[model samples]
Target: MYYTLHQLQIFLKISELQSITRASEELHLTQPAVSIQLKNFQDQFPIPLTEVVGRQLFITDFGKEIARAAEKIINQVEEINYKTMAYQGNLSGRLKISVVSTGKYVMPYFMADFMTENKGVDLIMDVTNKSKVVRSLELNEVDFALVSVLPEKLKVDTVELMPNKLFYVSNYDRKFPKAVSKKYLFEKIPLIYREPGSATRNAMESFIEKNNYSVHKKIELTSNEAVKQAVISGLGCSIMPLIGNKNALKNNELKIIPVRGLPITTTWNLIWLKSKNLSPVAVAFLNYLKDRKEGIIQKKFSWIEDFINV
Candidate 1:
């Protein structure tokens, strides 16, 4: 039942290269050594394998099938080896992560950089709204989640990475200043708010309730992109994460509300079950994150320097 991998490699190389000379060159083996390995393989397998047509040699149908199976075995062996090495160093398993839609702008910057250094690690991701990000972690559908609100009374550990300041953005033509009181900010602008039950909506509502401020009449919508488009068209002003419309801000399509207290400031946290058994790969990535626990943005993302401890 056991066969030498060298012999199997020899068979596969020969089957693929066809010519003995070419297979030998491809394997960095002398022709005679290639021949001997194939001979060993044929003797061990319970079937005919090689034949000659004039001066050319060929493998039988069963031989080619066995060669294909050998490829699978080699692939599996390599996968195991890479995983083992990655795990031993720190990270080496499938790490499933979930994040709020806004994190689509932030998390990948860090995740990709870390993964680039860990050759053996693999990352799986799900991006959704903030509420679903928390639910996925609580339901164990994902190992970790990036979200704005940290769930209380849950057996989870959270690391705050950065401050995501919500800004009231409008076209510069609106002539809003850089610092406005909470009362003045809400009273002046027509609000373009996120949909009811949305995480952003919940956060905004809590802030408004705590301050006892009445917001001006405004439109409510679901899609972040749509909201940005509305703001660009000057349909009205809306509050959004800096991460949410960093591009629009950069492009000068919209500007922050001059009144500073109108929007709000919040932090983003990475959450995971306190008692979850992390795979080696996941652990490697997590540890790497702890070291860089600040936050990451795209190469040019402006958030890296924003976190005091990062």
Candidate 2:
């Protein structure tokens, strides 16, 4: 009954992490300071909130319940702050978005100006595989989902933002003829692939099937950076998006192979469920994208065109 919000916050952090040490590191407080706060917080309650055995710290059942309550309290407090800012004619709230891995390259550029203008807004972006991004969108867990491939099952509205071009790339040192054959690239060359659930992998598979090319799958990687590094290491070539490979292509770490029907293209879209009501911040972001997407692409992503054309 007599606990401070600071104490509740510390306890909540400790409960979530189950480690005073880790909670301190995340909270930017010294271990001793966190320990003192946790002890003070525990003193006000009659029941045990946490326990330690061997080397592991555990939050008790009651502690977990309290942590849930604490989270609600914190969220409510944030809402109050946002409401205060809104009353002053400022758009203020958390803007949450989940993006497919390749989307990391594109979404941030779109968000940068909006975030700079709205200081009161909090941006939470999760960069994950396509399946997870789609799941987040399906659950309405995020305000928007950024992806190159549209989910087939979701009834969603989308704002088309930019072109996502996929191309075959190899180590810069690898030699290719002026006009490379798709059959040679797929059947002869060892090809790196992304893991199954990746949008890039789906795109690559679709291309291979469409062309009836039997690919030699050399290695499978989970992320774009990994696939890029693998190709750079001379492991194999991959069909990768030009957006993520610009620096590599520019620096000659990787080279685009000019095969026929190269640079498979898709539009990067910001999608939200049609049934989900848009929050003020979410609506503002959509409006911002409508007004500024072309300009943002022209400024930040125009370089990608050169790579795609190769």
lDDT of each: 0.74, 0.90
Residue 162's C-alpha lDDT in candidate 2? Answer: 86
Question: Model 2 over residues 1-310: C-alpha lDDT tens digits?
Answer: 7877788899898987789999999899999999998888888789988888998989889889988998899889999999999999998999999999989988999999999999999999999999999999998899999999899999999999988889889999998767767788899889999999998998898989999988765679999999999999998999999888878888989988877887889999999999999999999999999899889989998787666557
**TM accuracy, model 1:** 0.63
Candidate 2 TM-score over all chains jointly:
0.88
* Over 4 Å off, model 1: 1-91, 175-188, 260-263, 294-310
lDDT of 1 by residue, 242-291 (tens): 67775676678877654435446777788899988776666777788787
lDDT agreement of model 2 with the native? 0.90
Q: Would you estimate the TM-scores of all the predictions?
A: 0.63, 0.88
Question: Model 1's lDDT to the true fold?
Answer: 0.74
Determine which window of 10 residues in candidate 2 has minimal summed lDDT.
301-310
Please state the error at residue 178 of candidate 2 in Å. 7.3
